[model samples]
Every structure is written in structure tokens, then in C-alpha cells.
Target chain A: MAPVSLVSLGKAFGSIEAVRDIDLEIADNEFVVLVGPSGCGKSTTLRMIAGLETISRGELRIGETVVNHLSPGERDIAMVFQNYALYPHMNVAQNIAFGLRHRNLSRAEIKAAVLDAARLLDIEALLDRRPKALSGGQRQRVAMGRAIVRRPKVFLFDEPLSNLDAKLRAQMRIEIKRLHQRVPTTTIFVTHDQVEAMTMADRVVVMNNGVIEQVGTPLDVYNKPATRFVAEFIGSPSMNFFDGTLEAQGEDLVFRIGNGRALPVPRARGSAYSKHFGKRLTLGLRPEALSVSDASDFTIEVETKVVEPLGVETIVYFDLAGHPASVRAAPNRAPRAGETVPLSFDMTFMHLIDPEDGSVIPY
Target chain B: MVSRGGILANVATYAAAVLIAAFFLVPLTWLVSLALRTPQEIFFGASRFIPENPTLDNFGQVLRDRGFLNYLWNALKLSGLGALGSVIVAAPAAYAFSRFDFRGRGVMMMAILAVQMVSGLVILIPLYRYMGWLGLLETHVGVIAIYIAIGLPITVWLLKTAFDGVPIVLEEAAAIDGYGHFETFLRITLPLASPGMASALILNMILNWSQFLVPFIMLSRDAQWPISVAIYNYAGSTTASTTHLLAAACLITILPAILAFLLLQRAIVSALTAGAIKG
Candidate 1:
């Protein structure tokens, strides 16, 4: 395994820039996931690293060798495509052994390697079956086996689990993590699904448009999203935003919303916004941070528009001034629609964003 | 659970199909009957649909003819080589058309397709002159070259569509598997496209087998004549006694093409319609 570094890497198709200049260093044996919405250049970045796509400008190095000018075969990388591009004509064993053809391995060595990979993937019984005969999950396993059998310097996955059902995707996610733990190859996985990125990556690189928004451990990105895009994109049900101006009330700061209701910011966190008092800001709140309990620092009464009770927890969606917001509550305590429920805000978990540029305040 | 209306529609469809089949099959049946007849029956009972007494003597006599065997060999050689050569020459161009987005690709494809619209007879004289200047006249190579040229446009189109049906991602997967561009095409794309190549081969074989004018003009010696032209020659010199022999020769010439179609019918149809619906 070897580290990969992309120094000011970019990709352009004619005049349209698909991936802007982005720098990243991926350590050897590290599992890095590039997560973003569709067309966010995550896949483009992965493809560039795999040498499937050419770099428009800047350098890409795998270990110490620059691979910007190399073809995919010359780059010593294996990619598992979204569709699990197994050769339909070849059975599983042949498909898995396909890469070894250029490795100068003897027939016995290749056979043994194929068997070992099949056993590792728990696909020994499927060795003689063609890809068409395999189920979705089995096909995905074979795709992984094809990549892992080569023991290439890096493994590239382009939304490989996107083709599977939800349960299968979850199972494969863990299987991939376990596989990486066992082999510890440097891997770059790209996905539009944030949950996959959060659960799988050693470090999550959240991208937007064509640039990196944040690159950190999943908790770092989730707990302290660096930008408004990261705060919204990384969470299910999304974070809510309210346009407001910060006002000083004694020593504590208060966030005054459009409707003129004020949420008193906790005094311990007030110093971070004291300098920005009277400036327009957007307050970001995670759904889980709002509850019916009075344990929070600030509280507001909202007329619930929808309540979704998902057994474990309930999500109460409401309009905060003019913006949509939701609060997660205990399933037994969810307020019904149209009810004026007291929603408490956990100010310690809140983010104050710069409304002009969508950047979160350092605090 | 077919409804009454559906049953009626099915009956009507079958009736129309049978009528169309009869439109083409009656002459073929008559030819078979003529081929089975004795010389006496062929001479006196030509109007009858069924022979008074059928005999295998005509088939036996035609099969024994050295000239007929030579014509059969010539036809097989020319058609086989033409089909194989056409696919070999067309496959790379087809792959380019299928996979690459070079400038003017669509326009070039249209230009290649336009070649098929022109009748072979329109170009046969010029082709014959060109072959003569190249010292290829009256040779198997001359006739086969014309066949390959005439067959190329459709072969290229058939193979292009076949190549298209083989997913692009498979090639990418092969590339990541350490296979170069040519190796990927050979090992991944070509195998996936075998049905199309098979279809193209059979199609060109059928087209070149029945070819008359090109070989009829390019080949001067009767010894070098393919079955189609040889059969035509035989029909021109037919006497009353040899009419049954001529019918047997016609059946011999037509059987190979029909058998080839019957054998590879599924491959041909699948190649034609494979990519109509994609996942």
C-alpha cells in the first residue's frame, strides 16, 4: 500500500470545469471517502486518481510516482464500478483471476489466489457461476473480490454499493470495512450517500460544487461542520437555518429571528458573537438538538406541521419564523400536527453561520 | 387467459402470416417437386404441381457433376472469405464508432451508411474496371474483394451496435485490471460482442452467396463462376431433358443460405434488437 497525494488537482471537460483545484493527501492504508451530492466532482476526483480521467492541471502522485500521465492499467490501481462490471462471459473464478494475467503468475498460483479470494468473500460456491447467475449482493462481493485479489496499491470504489438494496448495502458496508481492516490497503471510495461516507471513511471529505468543503473524521464533520453545506449535507433530515441578527442583551447575545422572537444565546458561548452583534447571521440547529425538555438553554413555541414517529424517536417538523425546522423527541412525547409545542434549543450544539458567505463562525 | 377479441386477433394474424408464407413458399415447393422429378416427368408434366413419379436420379446426377462441385466450392470460398474479411475489416471501425467520440464521427457513420443505399449494379462496371487496372480480373480475389467492399457498410453498422451493447464500464473495469486498450477490446469487448460478429458474418455470407452481378462480370471463365452465376449459366443452356437437373442445382445453391439463417436465427435477431431496452 502507498499514499496518494493530489496537489491542486482539477478536471475540465472542454470549457466546463468538473473538478476545481483541490489538494488532498491520503495516507497509506487509510480509507478515505469522497462524499458529495451528485455532480459535486467526487466521482471525478476518484476517477482522476484511478487514471480513468486525465488531470486538467496539477499533479497526482501515488506513493512517490506521479501518475498524471499514466493510463489506468499503468497506474496499478483497481476500481469497483457502480455497476459491478464483471465480465458476463466469464465465470466468477476467471473474473477474479483476470488481473493476474499480466502479473506473470503461474497457473497454480493464480488458481490458489482465486480460491483464496473466493473464500475470503465467501463466494467459493459461486466460483463457476457467471455474473448473470449471481444476485445483487453476490455480484457486489465478486466485484470486491476482483479488486482485492490484485492487492493493488489502492482500491477505488465508485458508488459500488449503490446498486444493492438498503439491507444489502449496510451489510456490504461492514464487509468492506472488515476487508479493509484485514488487508489495510489505501482506498478511495466515492459516494453520494453521506451515511455511507460517515460510517466507512477513516476521514470524510465532504465536497460541494467542485471543491472540498471539509475533510476530517466523520464525527469532526458531523459535530463541527466547517460550512453551511457540510452542516446540511452530512445529516439526515438536514439542519435547519434561520436568518437573524445577533443582539447584545446585557453580556449575553440574543439571536433575533425574522418574526422578532429572540433566543438568548448561552452566556458561556456569548463572547464568540459579541463582536458580531447587530450583524446578520444564520443560526443552524440539528434536529436532535431540539427537544420538548427544558434542559436546553433557549426555548420557542412552534405550531407543529408534521410529526413522524419512527418507533425509536419522533421527528416534529415545524416552521420557525419563515424557515422550516424539525425537532427530534422521544417517541412517546411527539406533539401532533397543529399543536403549539415548546421546542427547546441546545445552544451548545448550535452553529452561527455567516449569512453572506455560508461559512460557520469559528465558535 | 386470452379474451375472445385476442383469440380473433391471433387467428387473423396467423391467417395473414400463412398467406404471406404461401406467397413465398409456393415457388420453392414447385422447385423441390421439379428437382425430384424424372427427366420424362419434367418434360411432359411441367404444368403439374406434383410429379407423376419422383426420382432421386436428378440429384444424383447433379451431385456427380465435377463442374457443379467446382461452382459450389467457388461460391463457398468466396462467400466465407468475404464474410470473414468484411468482419475483420469492419470490426475496428465499428469499435471506433461505438466507443470514441472523435470529431465528425456521426457524419462519418452516415457517410458509411450511404454507401449501402447505392445499388451494387450501379458501381459494378467501375469496380470491374478498377479490378482490371489492378490486375485482379477473373480471379477469386477480385470477386471476394468486391464482396467484402459491398458487405462492409452493413457489417460495420451491425458490429457497431453490438459493440455499443457491450457496456463501456466493462472496458473501464478491464483497464483497471491491468489490460491495455487493445487487450481490453480483444478480451472484454470482442467476447461480449460475439453474437453481433456472428450475426454480421452470417448476414454477409447470405448477401455474398446470392451475389450474381459482381462475380458474373468480374469472373470471365465459367470454371471460376460461383453457384449463382453458374446456375444462371446452366438455366440459359437448359434443354428439356436437363430441366430437372437444373432444378436440383438451384435447390443445392439455395440450401446452404437457408440452413445458415436457420442455424443462427436467434443470434442474428438478438444482435439486431439487443440494445433496444437498457437497464
Candidate 2:
């Protein structure tokens, strides 16, 4: 396996830029996930690295050799496409052995390699069956098996599990993670699902609007997001944002919400928002960061609109002075609709962003 | 209860369908009856739906006396070669036009469509002079080449539609698995397009087989003539009467195309509908 690096890469189709100035370094034997919403250029960046797309500008290197001008075949990479594009005419064994046939291997070696990959993927009994005859999960294994037999320096996956049912997607996600653990190639996976990125990545690169938003470990991004987009996108039920003003109150800075509720700012955030006093800012709080308690230092009275019972936990949807907000609470203590609930804010996890530019205020 | 207008509409639909079917089948049925009638009956009898005395004498006479077998062979050779040659040349060009974005792709596609729009008869003089200058004027090669040129524009258009139906993901998978663009075309794209290619070949063969004007203008020698030109000779020759000329030669000339269509009907239907419901 080889480490790959892309420097200032960009791709444009006429006047529209699909990807812009992306620079990333993927270390050898690391599992990196590129996560973003649709049209955010995560897939485009991966295709550029795979050489399936032309780089409008910048350079790509694989282990010290520039590969921008090389074709996908010469770049020594294998890609598992979103649709699992198995050749409809070929059976499982034939599909797995196709890439090896062009190599200088003998028939026996090719057969051994295919059998080994099939066995690794636990698809040994499916070797004789065509792709159409297999289930979706079986077809996914075959797609992976086809890539494994080539044993390239890098493996690129473009939302390979998006077509499967939920249960099968979870199963195949584990299967792909386990396969990477076994082979340990430098792998780059692209997905619009942040859960997949959080669960499977050694390093997750969050992208938005054709640019990299943040790159860090899963916990690093969750606990300390560099931008409001990352903070909002990385969690379920999304982080809630309240437009407010940062002001000095008795020698301490506090964010005053619209209903005259004010929460003291954390000390770590003071340096970031020091110059933004008397200016508009956005306060981001994750659903888990807000707890339901009777006695707390700061509380926001919210009228519950809806309650969703999720067995272990319940999501309480309510209006915080007419602004929408949701809180995660114990299922047994979940509040009823139209009931007023006192929500205690966890200021330690509070995030502050500049309302004008949507950039996170450093602290 | 159903309305009177709805019942009348149903009756009218059935009547229209039957009328269209009869319109297509009547000429073929008449041709068959004419082929079976004797020369005397055809000349003297009333114009009837059925023959008074059916016989195989016209078929036998044409086969034995008129060198019909040689003409049939010439037509088959020319049409078969022309269809195969046109498909082989057009398939690659069609693939390029369908898949690639080159500098003059739109202009090139428009040029092909423009070629199809021009009538072959209007270019007869220029084509004839070009063939004469190349010393291919009276040969089967000259006729076959002209047929290929005439059939190419539409053949490319048909095959290009076929190639465009194949998903780009399949080709990209092949490319990442070490196949080049041409290799991917040969391995993935062509197999998916087999039905369309077969349909295009069948269509072009029918067009070239029944072609009359180009061969009529290009070839001067009887020995090198295709069935179309040979049938024209029967129309002018004194040995065969008009009734015999129409019955025997027409039936013989149409048999191969009918057989080809019968063999490829299923593929043709599927090829026509393959791109209708793509995912």
C-alpha cells in the first residue's frame, strides 16, 4: 500500500465547479472517509484521486509519483461504485478474475487469487452464480471481491452501501470495515451519511460546497468542530442554532436569547468572541447538551409541541420562545405535548458562530 | 349502463385496426395469388381473388431458364457484405459520438443527420461519376460501396442510441479493472448492444436488398448486376411476359429479407425498447 496526496485539486465542467482546491494527504494503511451532503464534491474528490475524472488544476501523487496524467488502470487503484457495477454477462468468479487476466499471471494463479478473495468475502458458494441471481448483500460482496483480487495500492468506494436496505447496509458496513482491517490498504470512502463516516473512519474529512470544512478524528469533530456546518452535520437531530447577541453583563460575556434568557459564556470561548461584543452571533447547542432539570443555573421555558418515543431515549420537540428546538431525554421522563419544560443549557458544550459568515468563533 | 358513444368508439377502434391489417396484407396476398396463376389464366381470366388453376410452372421456368439463382446469389452477396461493412464501420463511430465530448461533436452529429436528410436520388449523378472515375462503375463492389454509404448515416444513428443506453458506471468499472476505453467497448458496451447491432444490421440489409436506384445507375454490365438490376432486365426482355416477370422475380427477390426478419424479430423488439425504462 502507498500513501496518496492531492495538492490544490479542482475540477470544473465549463462554468460550474464540481470540486475546488481540495488538498488532502491519506497515509498508508489508513481508512479515511469523506463525508458531505449531496453536491458537496466528496465523490468528485474521490473520483479525481481514482483517476476516473480529470483534474482541472493541481497535482495528484501516489507514493512520490505524479498520477494526474495516468489513466485509472495505470494509477493502481480499484473502485467499488455505488451501483456495484458487476459485468452482467460474467459470473462471480469471472468478474473477480477479470482484472487478473490482463496481468502476467497463469491460469492457476488467477484461479487461486479469485478463490482466495471469494473465500475472504465468504462468497465461496456464490462463485458460479451470476450477479442477477444473487441478493443485494451477495452482490455487494462480489463487488468487494472483485476489487480485492486486484490488491491495488488504494481502494476507492463511492457510497457502496447506499442501495442496500437498512439492515443490510449496517451489515455490509461492518463487513467493509472488517475487510479493511484484514487487508489494511490505504482506503478512501465517500458517503453522504455522517453515521458511516463517524463509525468507519480513522479520519473523517467533512466537506461543504466544494470545499473541505474540517478533517479530524470522529470524536475530535464531534467534540470540537471547527465550523458551524460540521457541528450541525455530524450529529443526529442536528445541533440547534439560536440567533442572538453577545454582550458584556457584570464583567462576563453572555449570549442573550430573544426571550431575555442569558447564559454565561464558557471561558475557553472568550478569546474567540472577544471582539464580537454587541454584535450578532449564533449559539449552537446539540440536543444532548441540553438537559431537563427543575433546578439549574440557566433555564429556557419551552412549550412542548411533539414528543417522539425512541424506546431508550425520547426526543421532545418544543418551541423555545417560538424558535424550534428539540431535546433528548429519558423515555420515562419525556414531557407531554403543550406542557412547559425547563431546559438547562450545558454551557461547556455550547458553540458560538459569527451570524454574518457562519464561521465558528474560536475559543 | 354504458353510453352509446362509448360502444360506437369501441366498434370504430376495431374497424380501424382491421382496416389497417387488411391494407398491409392485401398486396402480399395478391402477389402470392399471381405467382400461382398460369400465364393463360392470368391474361384471359377475370380479375379474381383466387387463381383458376394454380401451378409451379412459373417458378420452375424462372429457375431453369432465366438465371434467377445467379441473380439471387449476387443480391445476397452484395447486401450481406454491405450491411456487415456498414455496421462494422458505424458501430465504432456511433460509440464515439455517443460517449465522448470532443471539439466538433455537435457539428459532427448534425452532419450525420444532414446526410440522412438528403435523398439518394439527388446525388445519383455525382455518385455515378465518382464511381466511374475510380474504375468501379460496372462491378458488384461499386454497388455494395454505394449501398454502404447510403445506409451508414441511419445505421450510425441507430447504433449510437444503443450505445448511449448503457450506463457509464459499467464502463468506468471496466476501466478501473484495467481495461482501456477500447477494451471496455469491446467487452462491456458491445455485448450490451448486441441486440441493437443485430437490429441495425437487419434494417440495413432490408434497405440494401430492396434498393433499386443506386444499382440501376451505377452498374452497366448484366453479369455484375444485382437482383434489382436483373429484375429490370426481365421487365425489358422479350423472353418473359409481364405477368411472369412480376410474379417470379418479385417473390425470389423478397424471400431473403423475409427470412432475415423472421429470424431477428424478438431481438429487434427488445432492442427498440431497451432504453425506455432505465434506472
Candidate 3:
């Protein structure tokens, strides 16, 4: 497999830019995921790589050659669509062997290749059944088999697991990741699901409004998300943000929310916030980053709203200085709704974002 | 919890449905009774729904006549060939209409609808003159060509609609699998839209099989006359004034059309328009 690279690739439908001039280079055998909200151009970029949609501007290179002018057939890439796109009229075996038929492969060669794929995908017994007869997961495997039989230079997946139910989605997600590990083709997978991105990708490319927000490893982006968009978008039960101002209270760097409630920006991150003394900023804290604290160590007092008991750990929802926020706590320690509680940030996990631009405040 | 009003509404609905069925079925039952009767019974004796001595003699006579057989063959050839030719021409054309965004796609679609929009009678004389200029009159080929022209617009429109319903993603999938647009169309789009194509073919056959005007205008020569034209001429023939013989020939001509309707009536109706509207 060869590397796929995009240099300032941009696509526009008339005046509306679907994808802005974006740059990315996917290394050979890497599983890179483009994760974003819908209409953020992740699918558009994957389609551009597959030669399904035209690259309106900038360069697209699959392997060593520029493929902007190439047709999908000439580009030598296989795509797994969200709906699985198995030809309804063909049986499973024919569907898997479809791509190879166009090549100069012999009959025996095609059969062997198809059987190999069917076996690899655990669909050997289903080769005779038409797509309508198979379950959704089976059809998806057939789709993957179709792609794998081609053994193309690049593999593009556009929300491939979106159609399956939650349990099946989780199962197929592992199967896809496992398939990638075995095959290791230069793969560009696009999905709006951040969990899929975090679980499967070697690198996650976060995007919003047709522009790339950040590109890094899943943990790198998760731990130090470069923008507010990426920071909140990457985690479940999304990170909470409080609109506030940063001011120096002598030795303490205090964040003052409305109603004169001030939370100290832990002394460890003092060097980072020392430069933004009186500037307006947004403080972000995940549910896990906040812990039930005593009044002496408390950042602020919050009135509890709803307590969700999740067996292992209960999630306490409360209004933190008029903004909705949650705190991770033990089930026994979780406070009841309408009761006020003291909470403090884990400090090392806090995300301070610039409201003027949405970029994360650098430490 | 049976409401009096609800029971009355159900009874009224069923009674209306039966009335409508009888309204259509009465003529068909009358036709069968007429075809079974002897010439004496039809022309002079009491006109009854059931004959005193019901006979298949009229059917035997109609089937035995060489002219009648020739007419039947010509009609079958014209309609069958016309339907096949129309589908063959329309499949790719419809696929193009469905998938491609050419410079004149909207204009072309408008033109297809325009063909159906304009009354055939309005263009009949011109079509006749055009066919005459080509010396295409008085032949089965000429009549079939006319049938194709009449069927082409709707066939293309309906098939295009069906092709539209087959997701373009399948074609894209085929392309990624190393097939060209043509192969994708043939193996993917065409097979997926088979129901629509079959509907178009059956509808075209039914249309051409029963067409009285186009065939009547084109195939004036006795050797090339389809059963529809022959039946039309039979109404004017002095030798076939006997009601039983006339009814028998009429039954023969309409039999294929009735059977076509019975077999693919839903197919024809469901594929009337393109995509979401399904007109």
C-alpha cells in the first residue's frame, strides 16, 4: 500500500465551499480518521481521495502520482459506503469477486481470491446467498470483502458502521480495526463519531466549518485539544465550558465567573495563565476532571440538578455558576438535586480556551 | 364497542365497492356470453346473457381463418417488437437521464414530458406525411415504428424514474470496483431497475396492442394489417354484419390486451412516474 497525501485540497459547490484548502499526509499503512460534525467536509475529503468527488482546487496524490484528473476506476482505491452498497442482484461470492473480474485474472484465480476473502471475513458459508438474505453485519462484511479482494492502494471508509445498531456497531468497529491491522493499507476513514475515531485511528484529524481544527494522535488531541471545537468534540458527555475572566489575585490566578464566584486556576498552571491576567476566557472541565471536595479546597459552590446513577460511578449534574456542568463522584458520595455542593478541578485536566478565537490557551 | 355509525359506514363502503365491480364486470360478462352464442341466437333469437346452446364454434371459426391468424400475428409482432425496441432504446437513454448532468439535461427531460404533453392526434397528420415521405406506410415496420414513437416518451420517462430510484451510490461503488460508467450502468443500474423496465415494456405492449389510430393510419395494406386495424375494418365490413362473428373477432383482438392488463396492471401503474412522485 502507498501513502495518500492532500496538499491544500479544497472543494466548492459554486460559491459555497464544501471543503476549504486543507492539507494532510496519511503515511503508508496508517489508519487515519477524519472526525467532525456533519458538513465539516470529512466525507468530502474521503470522496476526493477515492476520486468520487472532484477536487475543486489543490493537489491530491495517491502513492507517488497526482490523481486529481483520474477517474475512480483509474485511482485504484476501494470504498466502503455507509449503507454497505452490496449489489442486490449478485450473491455474496459475486459481490466479493466483482472488482477482480475487471482485471486480467483467470477464473480459478478469481474464485480462489473470492474464497480467500470470504474465509477472511467469515462469510464462506454465505457465498451463495444474495445480499437481501444476509443480515446488516453480513452485508457489511461482504462490502469489506469486495474491497479486500481488490487489494487497492488505499481504502476509504465513509461512516461504514453508521447503519448498524449500537451493539453491532461496536462489534463491526473492532472487526474493521482488526481487519486494518491485518491488511494495513493506507486507510482514510471518515465518521462524525469521535468514539470511532478514538478507538480506531492512529491519527485523528478534527475539522469544523470545512477547515481542519487539529491533526494529531487520538490521545494527543484528547489530552491537549488545540481548539475548543476539538476539545469538546472528542469526549463523551462533552466537556463543560464557563464564560469568565482571568484575573491575578496576588499569588493566585483566579477565574471569576458571574455572581463574583471565583475559582483558582490551580497553582501548577500558574505559568500558563500569568500572561493572560485580565483577559476574557472560557474554562472547560470534563465530568471526570471535577471531584467532590471539601469547602476548604472547593473551586466553587454549585446547586445540584440531577444525579444519574451509573452503577460503578454516579454522575452528578448541577448548575456551576449558572452554566450546566457535571461532576464524577462515587455513588454514595453523589449529592442530591437542589442541594449545594463543593467541587474542585483535578487541575491537570483543565482546558482554558480563548473566547476571542476558540483556540486552547497554551501552557 | 361496536358503534352503529361505524357498522353503517363499513356496509356502505362494501356496497359501493361491489357496485363499482359490477359496473366494470357487466360488459365483460356480456362480451363472453355474446362470443359463446350461435349466429341465429345473436342475430334473431332472444338476446340473453346465456345462450340456449352455447358453442365454441365462433372461437373455432375465428382461430381457423387465415386472415384472422395473419392479423393476430401482425399485431403481436408490432406490439412485441415495438415494446422490445422501445426498452432497448430507452434503458441507456433513461440511465443517462437519471445519472448524467449534461448541458441540456433539464431541457431534455422537459422535451420527454413535452412529447407526452402534446396530443398524438394533433401530430397525427404530420406523422403520416413524414412516414409517407419515408415510404414507410403499408408495412409492419412502419406501424411498429409509429408504435415505438408513441411508447418511447413514456417508457424513457418511467424507466428514468426507476433508474433514479436506484441509488447512484451503487454506480459509484461499481466504479471504485474498476468498472466504467457503461459497465456500471449495465450490471448495476439496469438490473436494479428491472421492475421499472418490465413495467415500461408491458405498458408499451398493452398500448401498441390496442392502438387503433396509428396502425389504422400506417398499415392500410390488407397483408400488413394488425388485428386492431382489422377489427376496426370489420365494423365497416358488410360481409361481417352477423353479430356473433363480429363479436368473436373483437374478442380475439382484445384478448391479448385484457391478459396483458391482468398480468402487469400494478407494474404499469406503479412505474407511471419518476422517483418520489410515482405518478
Candidate 4:
């Protein structure tokens, strides 16, 4: 295994820049996921690292050697593609042994390697079957098996589970995570799905508009997002943002959401917001941080619009001061649509941001 | 429980299909009937489905006297060489066009399509002059070379379409698996493109086997002639009997092409269907 680092990487096609200057370092035996919306250059970054794409500018290093000009084969990497690109003519065993055949390994060694990979992926019985004969999940396993047999320095996955059905995607997600544990190669996975990134990454790199927004642990990105884009992009159902202004009242900093409705700011967050006083700001609050309470520090009346019951928890969509927002509540007492619910805001969990630049207030 | 109109429509559809099949088979049936009759009987006997007295003399005469087997072998050799040459030259160019983003790609593709539009007859004199300039006139190599060059545009276009249908992800995956671009194309792309190649080869073989003008203009030696040119010799010869000309030479010339079609029918059907469905 080898640590890979990309410094100030950029890729441009003609006049359009697909990926801008980006720098990231992936540690040895670490699984880093690049997550973003479509056309966000996550896949382009991964391809540049794999040497499948040329880097327009910047340096890429695998361990100590710069690999920007090296061919993909010389880079010693394996990739699982989104479509599971198994060789149609070759059966599962031949597909898995294709890489080993290029080396000077003996036939017996190739067979043993294929067998070991098949056994690891639980696809030994499918060795003789062609790609067309296998089911989607089976083809996925064979694709992974092909990569596993190579045992390259790095493993790249380009949305490998996107083609599978929902149930199979969930199942394969766990399988991939377990496989990473066993192999422990430096892996870079690219996906548009935040759930996959959060579940599988050792460190998640959230990207937007061809730039890295933040790189940290899953919980770290969720809890302490460096920017507003990371805060909204990392969580399920997304974080809700409300336009507000920062003001000082009696030696305390507060965010005024609307006329006469103000929420107290935490001291740590207050220090971050002091420089932006009287300027337009945005407040980000996760659904779980808001709840219904009779005696609360700050109260807001909302008209419930939708209720989603998920056995353990319920999602309540309501209008808060004319802005639509959702709140996750205990399933024991779920609110119904059209009911006016009194919700309490947890000021400590509130996130403040600059509305002009959409950067977090560094709290 | 069926309605009368539905039954009538079904009968009409079946009758139309049978009529079309009969219309297509009638020419071959006539040829077979003429082959069975003797020269005198063909002229004297009444028109019938079967001959009064069938004979194998035409087949014997063509094989023994006319050297039909040699002509058939020459045709096979020329068509085989021409098709192989075209495939070899076209596959790499097609792969490049399909996979790369070079400048003038659109113009190059349009040029290839334009070449296909120009008939071989229109360029006959210029091609002959070029071959003579290269010191290749009156040679089988000259004829096969011309056929390969004429057939390359279509063959390359067909293979390019096939290569385009294969997703780039497959090549990327192969590259990451320690295979270079050329190795990936050989091991993965070419194998996946077998159906398209087979279809193009069959089409090119048919075209080369039935070619008349190029071989006629290039080859002055009768021994170097393909079956098509050889059959034309018999047709134009005034000394040869009409029975031998119609039965022996024509049937002998077409037999190999018919056999080739029969042998590769499955691949041809699948290839045609693949092109249609993909489009």
C-alpha cells in the first residue's frame, strides 16, 4: 500500500475547466470518498489520480514518485467502474486473471490468485460463467474480484454500487466496507450519494463546483462543517437555512430571524459572528436540533404541512416564520398536517453563516 | 371465437409472405431446372417444372473442361486476401476515431462517408492508372489491393460504430487492471467487436467475390481471373453452347458465395439485428 497525494490538481477541456486547483492527501490504508452532485468533478479527480485522465496542471504523487505522466497500467491501481466493466468474452476466471497474465507469474500461481479472489468475494462457483450469465450483483462481485486479484497499491471505485437495485446497493455497500477492511489499500471512492460517502469513507472529502469544500471524518464534517455547502450536502434530508441578521442586544449576540423573533447565540458562535454584525447572515439548524416545548427560551409558531412516520422517528414538515422547514421528532407523539405546532429552537446547535459568501462563521 | 375480418387478415398476411418467398426462389429454381436438362432437351422440350430426362453432363463438363474449380479457388483467394487487408487496415483507424478527441475528427469522419458514396466504376480509370504506375497491372495483387481500398471506408465505419457502442468505462477498468491501451483493445474491445467484424467481413467478401470491373480492367491473364470474370468469359464466348454457358458457368460461379452466406447466416442475422437495435 502507498499513500497518495494530489497537490493543486486541475483539468481543463478546451476552454471549460472541469476541475480547479485541488489538493488532498490520502493516507496509507485509508478509504477517502469524494462526494458531490453531478458534474462536480469528483470523478474527474479520481480519474486523474488513476492516470486514466491527464492532469492539466499540478503534481500527483504515489508514495514518493510523481505519477502525473505515468500510464494507468504503470500506476499500479485497480478501479471498479459504475457499470462493472467485465470482459464479455472471458468468463469470470479469465477476467480476474487478465492482469496476472501480463506478469511473469506461472499458470499455477495465476489460478491460485484467481481462486483466492473468488473465494474472498464468494464468487468461486461463478468462475466459468460469462458476464452476460451473471446477475447484476454477481457481475459486481466479479468486477471487485478482478480488482482484488491485482492487489495494487491503490483501489479506485467510481460509483461502483450505483447500478445495483436499492436493496442490493445497501448489501454491496457493507460488502465493500468489509473488503476495504481486509485489503487495507489506499482507496479513493467517488459518489454523488452522500449516504455512501458517510457510511464508507474513513475521511470524507465534500466537493462543490470542482473544488474541495472540506475534508474530515464523517461526523466531523457533519458536526463542524467548514462551509455552508458542506453543512447542507453531508446530511440526510439536508440542513435547513433561514435568512437572518446578526445584532447585539444587551451585551449578548443574537440572530434575528424575522420581526421580533430572536434566538440567543452560543458564546463560541458569538465570537465567530462578532465581525459580521449588522450584516445579512444565514442560520443553519438540523431537524433533530429543533423540538416542541411549552417552556422554552425561544419559541416559534409553525403550521405543520407534512408528517412522515419511520417507526423510530417521525419527520415533521412545517412553515416557520414563512420559511419551510422540517424537524425530526420522537414517534411517540407525532404532529399532523394543518396543526399549529409550537417549536423550540436549540441555540447552542444553531449554525451561523455569511449569506453573501455562504461560508460558515467558524464556530 | 375469432372474427371473420381477423381470419381474412391472417390469411392475407400468410399468402403475401409465401408469394414473396416464391418470387425470390423462382430464379434459382429456373437455374437448377436448366442445369438438369440437356442442351437439345432444353431447346426442344415443353416448358415444365421438371425435365423429362435429367443429366449430370453440364456439371461434369464444367468441372473437367472449363476448369471451374480453379476459378472458384482464385475467387476464394482474392476475396479472402481483400477482406483480410481491409480489416487489418480499418480496425486501428476505426478505434482511433471512436476513442480519441483529435482535431478534425468530424471532417475525417465525413471524408470516410464521402468515400463510401463514390462508386468504384467512377474511379476505375484513375485506379487503373495508379496500379499501372505502381507496376501492378495484370496482377492478382493489383486487383485485391484495389478491392481492399474500395471496401475500407465501409468496413472502418461499421467497426467504428461497434467500438462506439462499447462504453469507455470498460477500457478504463482494463487500464486500471494493469493493461495498456493496446492490450485493452486487443483483449477487450476487439473481442466485443467480433460480431461487427464478422458482418463487415461477410459484406466485403461478397463484394470482392462478385467484383467484375476492377478485375476485368486489371488482369489480362485468364488464369488470374476470379470466378465472376471467368463466368463473364463463358457468357461472352460465341463458341460455348448455351446449355453449358447458362448452367455450368453461372451456377459454378455463384455456388461458393451461396455456401458462404449459408454458413454465416446466424452471425449475419445477429449482426444486422445488433446494428438495427443499437441505432
The prediction achieving the highest TM-score against the true structure is: 1
lDDT tens per residue, model 2, B1-279: 879999999999999999999997887777778778877667643476587788888877877854677878888888889998899989989999999889999899889989999998898899888999999988888888888888899888889889997888999989888899888999999998877998988888888889888877877777767787788777676443467556767787787888877888777666656567764
- Give the Å error, residue A14, model 4: 1.5
TM-score of candidate 1 relative to the true fold: 0.96
For model 2, the interface Cα RMSD in angstroms equals 0.7
DockQ of 1: 0.83
Candidate 4 regions off by >4 Å? A293-297, B1-26, B44-46, B54-57, B64-66, B238-241, B262-266, B269-279
Note the chain A TM-score of all models in turn: 0.98, 0.98, 0.96, 0.97
- Model 3 stretches astray by more than 4 angstroms: B1-23, B44-46, B102-111, B238-241, B273-279
For every model shown, the clashing-pair count is 0, 0, 0, 0
- Residue B43 C-alpha lDDT in model 4: 70
Model 4 native-contact share: 0.88
The DockQ of each candidate is: 0.83, 0.73, 0.88, 0.74
- Best candidate per DockQ, number? 3
For model 1, what is the alpha-carbon lDDT of residue B132? 91
Candidate 1: docking tier: high
Query: How far in Å is the alpha carbon of B234 misplaced in model 4?
Result: 3.0
Task: Please give the distance, in angstroms, between residue B246's alpha carbon in candidate 2 and its true position after superposition.
Answer: 4.4
TM-score of 3: 0.95
Interface RMSD of each: 0.7, 0.7, 0.6, 1.1
All candidates' TM-scores? 0.96, 0.93, 0.95, 0.93
